[model samples]
Target: MREWLGWLDHIESVEDSLNNIKARIKAFADNGGYPESFAIIYNGEIAGTVGFNDVNKFNRIGVVGYWLGEKFQGNGIMTKAFESLIEYGFRELGLNRIEVSAAIDNKKSRALPEKLGFTQEGERRQAEWLYDRFVDHAFYGLLAEEWHSDNRED
Candidate 1:
């Protein structure tokens, strides 16, 4: 968890974890669901999370974020989750553009957007501070028209 998600390293206890979860929920509500989140359930257990963060209704844009437990990888769980999320962002939230960014070296995270038909935009140098070091981000974006055209059943 600490490898990619450095925040987990700060959670020293179960209480801390609970508090973090609470804070996230509060932020979601406070922002009018701009950072809407969803838990990925696998075999009746929470396997991960997928969400749209940094949502801007005025600009009709949102950034996608997600993480899956090590035990849950390679099961196609995130792929399905993101598919639904992208649909929700466009169809329900009326978003015109959605973006995704992942550590340049984190292939699994970066692959989600690519496999979902998101176009690779560019890389942000030292975009995130992960624990003791910075990591570059590979940015990708998908537009509403692109999604609709690709998904339309002709």
Candidate 2:
């Protein structure tokens, strides 16, 4: 996890990783607290993580966040991972909406939501604080109906 600091500015130490694991466990058990995180595997090797963040059960909404290792990117893996996640969110979790946001400058990360048919809503200025400075984020949203329309099998 330390090696991913370049792209994952949120992780700073071993303690952070341990704490994150604990939080993920708690989230999975609690069902509505923190984001439920999962390890993304590629060919049986750990590749990254994709999860539903800020889940609001009452509103049936959640935010999506993910990170992929540099070597694991560019193969349409994350896009497919997110596609399946969105389907699960709506079909199994009964969520009505899911949102994603990326730093405006992080074009690669920002592209996944767009590729998944998430509508570009707008930008949130300085919505995130990286290691050194604050960065603006571009927010995107997708409705369950929109997803079903695009992805449902006949």
Give the top-scoring candidate (lDDT).
1
lDDT of 1: 0.89
**Clashes in model 2: which pairs?**
none
Q: How close is candidate 2 to the true structure, as a TM-score?
A: 0.87
lDDT per residue as tens, model 1, 102-142: 99999888888999899999999999999889999999999
Per-model tally of clashing residue pairs: 0, 0
Off by over 4 Å in 1: 27-35
Candidate 1, residue 128: lDDT? 93
Best by TM-score: 1
Give one digit per residue, the lDDT tens place, for model 2 in 42-141.
9998888888868888999989888888899889988888877887788778899999988888888888998888999999998876767788889999
Worst 10 residues of 1 by lDDT: 27-36
Candidate 2 lDDT: 0.82
What TM-score does model 1 achieve against the real structure?
A: 0.89
